[model samples]
Target: MPDRAPQPVDRQLPTDEARDLIALVRDIVQREIAPRAAEEEEAGLFPREVFRLLSGSGLLALPYASEHGGGDQPYEVYLQVLEELAAARLTVGLGVSVHSLSCHALAGYGTKEQRAEHLPAMLGGGLLGAYCLSEPASGSDAASLRTKAVRDGDDWVLTGTKAWITHGPVADFLTVLARTGGEGARGITAFLVPGDAPGLSAAVPEKKMGMKGSPTAQLHFDGVRVPDSRRIGDEGQGFAIALSALDSGRLGIAACAVGVAQAALDQAVAYATDRTQFGRPIADFQGLRFMLADMATRIEAGRSLYLTAARLRDQGKPFSRQAAMAKLFCTDAAMGVTTDAVQVLGGYGYTQDFPVERYMREAKVLQIVEGTNQIQRMVIARHLAGPETR
Candidate 1:
């Protein structure tokens, strides 16, 4: 935030172990991520080696079971680590989230044999992953995806395109949702497809407003053959599984939103305290101070909202509605906080000389991804109104 390495987040971690984990994450961010973030992001370079370093450090597996090469930390802890990484660079933090999302189907619903065969390597094997649900025609309406998976001789030939896929071009594995039966949600199914499978290729990464370092592309499965063993859940169960992963994945986006907002707030505060006004520091002015206060308040509220949802998830409670709410509120908060950060720095913020401009650009995509804030509203309203009547 200060251009120099910012201090720790002063988090209220659940355990001493979690505190240590955050410290390690902060150190890594300072050493490996923060310094290179601006330059590499400008160049649109994906740091696969950094991801490997994360895998080797045990940071990649925090939310899963230790029995299967995971760190076994609860969602609460896992999320804060995401926040720290995000503070340094959104690409890395969101990359980790998508990796976890790609792994969710197998971890939550795979056969025990499937879990045994794949979970360990996926959790900590230095493998990058992608989740493919959004398609060219289907965005919020994931059940409408047209990707087809036709059964043949104990294999399924997948054919269609998955759009806006994070890590699509370079992922080592993908958790893909494809149509396996009749129309609508009941027809969908999930598969764990290897990225290198024949006929599975990625289009060029999209030119985007933010997080350019994170490749977002369309994955084409041109009669890509996947063994029956690679299926994550029963046929016609993919939509449900996709929703399940999104419930958790939305939380990851929420945490990343807070991290970005917090980084902006830190930057704004640092700028306000140093830059002189008519006579004294601009931070001494009532208007700027109020803005900073509001920024900090929003960031705190966002952190709380996501953490509450994370705790509910850890406790095995129904948290889908809460997750949507967190994703909605926190990401919107990030958009506002980052915009204000740029405003706080004025012209300097607009220039590439400061990182707040980048933060502002990055905050926008968070609102659109996972689920748009409009979609989140629909989710919350559905929970409250108990679905619309015909």
Candidate 2:
């Protein structure tokens, strides 16, 4: 197959340094991640080796501060790296994104002492992290979570179950949100709970429709004790912290969606050219070619949306609405593009032998996780309506 067409350049594209990082990440994804993605997915195993490689490559800390062993790259550059990784293997991409979100609480809200003690391990190591915000009854309405944390001298005793926790079983640490004050979002507090803490346990891994290599499990916090020092920010700041982290995390997911869409589009284009029909390639037909054109267009638009949001984030501007829009649009486009990719491949596309089918399966979860697309719409709508209306 010929090299895929160069990505369209936007007027607001990144600087030379950002472009170089994007290129490096793309090279790493194609060389190191693409080959192992299928096998790892088939085996239902998380790609620990890939995480180690990324840590060594300094990719894990792309969006963090350079003072703490991080690359401190702008979100505009960091998100493209995530996109490239997701194009090769979504499990790794999503895992890295979640880990980054887990670190956000510390980076944004932790005390100076907390940052000094924990940021190094988080930014420098191959260890993974999990964000504990969702519960069985409090996914979209996360502020209503019933997880409780009671003060106990110099520590807090946590007792609750966090459902749908990505990397639940294997994470080195979990940034847990629990009720500490009154009720609703204000009562919540964020705690950095060690994975191996007593009374903390993970349920059997969930069998999912996609992103199978990334484990999803329920985290049981049965009287888990955490030092008061592990609390992130003020006692009533958990909800705000979680929301802030998600604003950035949504961009990561959006970028991943764009990458997946691009991958599907590339596969469809290649397959359309090779599979002959009516004594000529199907790609020669205008009708099918139109579909390919649409797919390519959507992918580019999605890329543009996420990049714009990333730029807004880098500029320290209001990015919540844009992030939501990007997440909603890109994931929906990914689903469309991947489904079309399968149609272009016909019977072969539906089978395990093809990566497009896997891409299609993986696309569905992006719509659900990191706040469902429905929630994303609500966010965008609320933002558009202004704070007074909200």
- The top-ranked prediction according to lDDT is 1
TM-score of 2: 0.95
Residues 1-390, model 1: lDDT tens digits: 224455578789889999888888888898999989988998899999999999999988989888788998999999998998898899999999999999999999999899999988988999989999999999988888999999999999999999999999999999999999999999999999998999999999999999999999999999999999999889899899999999999999999999999988988998899999899999999999999999999999999999999999999999999999999999999999999999999999999889999999999999999899999999999999988788
| Worst lDDT 10-window in candidate 1 | 1-10
Residues 82-148 of candidate 2: C-alpha lDDT, one tens digit per residue:
8778878889888889999999999999998999899888887777799999999999999999999
Clashing pairs in 1: none
Which stretches of candidate 1 lie above 4 Å from their native place?
1-3
Model 2 alpha-carbon drift over 4 Å, by segment: 1-16, 386-390
Positional deviation of 156 in candidate 2, in angstroms? 0.4
For all predicted structures, in order, the TM-scores are 0.99, 0.95
User: Candidate 2 — number of clashing residue pairs?
Assistant: 0
Cα error, candidate 1, residue 136 (Å):
0.5
How many clashes does each candidate structure show, in the order listed? 0, 0
